[model samples]
Target: MVLGRQRRQIMKILIAIDSFKGSLSSKEAGEAIKSGILRVIPDAEVLISPLADGGEGTVETLVEALGGSLETVRVKGPLFQEAEAHYGILSDSQYSPKDEKLAVMEMSQASGITLVSPEERNPLKTGSYGVGEMILDAYHKGCRRFLIGIGGSATNDGGIGMLSALGFRFSKENGEEISPIGEGLKDLAGIENASVPEGLLQCSFQIACDVENPLYGENGASLIYGFQKGGNKELLSQMDLWMKHYSELVKEYNPAANPEAPGSGAAGGLGFAFRSFLQGELKSGVSLILEETKLSKKMQGADLVITGEGRLDEQSAMGKAPIGVAKLAKTQGIPVIAFAGTVTEGAKACNQAGIDAYFPILREITTLEDAMNKETAKQNLADTVEQAIRLYRLQHKKQ
Candidate 1:
């Protein structure tokens, strides 16, 4: 009988891990996995790579994992022009702005809800204006294909902030031009296509999104994720109404349109704004990250690929890093084991998709914070790996 713990190719092993979130960065996660590997097979040639899904720490994760370097830029923040913020961009790798390569950007860098303080959680006036500036910077740097990740945004202004930078205009009554803030949207009567930026129009644009929310109404951005941006019950209805009106305005501008377009509700109707106005393609963030990082190149020669994230469950199979890795590895005839912070109930179903095994590290943990401590998390992870590998050996040891 062949032991399940049989080496992938008699010796070499490659493991890839993503951040445990609030505890480990993807680098830390990879190191912890390596520590676990050392206990079982001391000589396993582990190839560790960090990963991010274009969320909070996407820039740093990509930079470190793919030998991409960091470039710092000062930009506008979500609110208060006096608010100066910094965003990290790829430097050494392919997305370098110096060489006019396409620069990847995630909405969280400029307009993420997490940046806002409790006092600053006013979504009514919050705008994606900073995101617009980032895109403009990329355009000026000669970046043609903008891979924009639309997630964790503070503003529900749709893509108006970005459109403004691209030379699109919203208008109020009496033909007065206006911005696209939610409150301002209430005053929006028409869209004036006069001011599209020459540079932006010449370039290509795409959205990295995992959501499928439509552009307007109940299934739209405002109704779905708006409350997280601090939308009260009243603003919820108001925001939806505003998006509905903008939807009509968008369709009037284009006959082949519906605010109800798939993924239209992403980024507070930013998806619709991008689709209708910027003519951007909406894609899954996981696929885009995988393509850019060229993970396949690293995974090519690996024996076994161990992938992980902060948690593993039904959602992991959707568009998360572990699921993406598992699917690709399975296709390549590689066995994939998933290690995670915690696995929800019914985690066995995780195997039906692509994962060969799932392990959760939360033992005797009461609160999430308790599980998130760095040393604790690392130890728990090591223990989980040790037990799992031992179990694999026990189950398949030849008689």
Candidate 2:
């Protein structure tokens, strides 16, 4: 007589996907995958963790994942005009101590190139003062830990604009205060921090930076990025010279300054300023997000792991968010499957990078606009995931 098969244990699945960019958010993508999984296994356990690459959607992804709140403040814009910016505050017990709060922000929200119209975009006239104001606002709200994504800036000021707002004064040879714009860097002769807030000293900063350009030279901020910020050849040359002078001054003031360090030129030298003055640590954006989300811990006991983003290509295999998640899941011997809106031939690299298999969610040929429609993307993602999970169940049943 054939023995009765033993009952199977409930399947546990962990989903951590990045935003679809102009389509679905990270949270929404995870929910869609969860819906698909539930359809396949009614009693399966599913955990959703939203993630970002420390770029555009970082604040929203972190806020949702950590159960945090958002705070908005009006601050100086790239051109020193009043601009509204929003940041996330995390008080979750899992991520922070009861008395400690963490603030997550993107510099683009305040000093981004998008804030300045193309005709008005000029690195010489732009500043990062708004970024500093945002930090101060969060500090006053009891936040001492900062996770800042410094990308898409409009200034080439060597971060003096942000420093000025943070109570660090920059002066010319005559000791007159210098304007906190890129042009001001040309005449800068002195740096003073006597007025810096005491609380700021106790704060710690983690900067999300992926670029490796130094403070000045060919690959520096001004020479490489200034042109995109509306700088002409002549202006970028001048700005690069000013950046060199500013780095020298910073080195003199902070003996430990490393102007040539990787990422020191990120965000028009805001990376240098953060490293030199605020003691911020620059790190890989995707790696930082993975650590903060506690993805490793969450993967524990998970029978399978699912991760993906808007697109899967060679770049995704080269340390993008989805591959980051897959690598971590691999460390624990969990199988990882990924789903994307579109898949390119280069995406085959993802298989070697820890994604056991990947599937494109698009069902039929359609216009980009229709594919990206919110409702349409959601339905497509749910349907694709459901089929994948059904196949997953069939494989398990054979065992």
Please write out the lDDT profile of model 1 over residues 54-154, one tens digit for every residue: 66677667756656435445566666353443334454435443454566677777777877887767768778877777777766765676777888888
Q: Residue 109 CA error for candidate 1 (Å)?
A: 3.0
- What is each predicted model's overall lDDT from 0 to 1? 0.74, 0.93
Which pairs clash in model 1? Answer: 166-197, 167-195, 167-196, 214-265
Give the number of colliding residue pairs in candidate 2.
Answer: 0
The RMSD (Cα, Å) of candidate 2 is 2.7
Colliding pairs, model 2: none
State the displacement of the C-alpha of residue 272, model 1, in Å, after optimal TM-score superposition: 1.1
| Cα RMSD (angstroms) for every candidate in the order listed | 4.6, 2.7
Candidate 2: residue 356 Cα off by (Å): 1.3
| Candidate 1, poorest ten consecutive residues by summed lDDT | 80-89
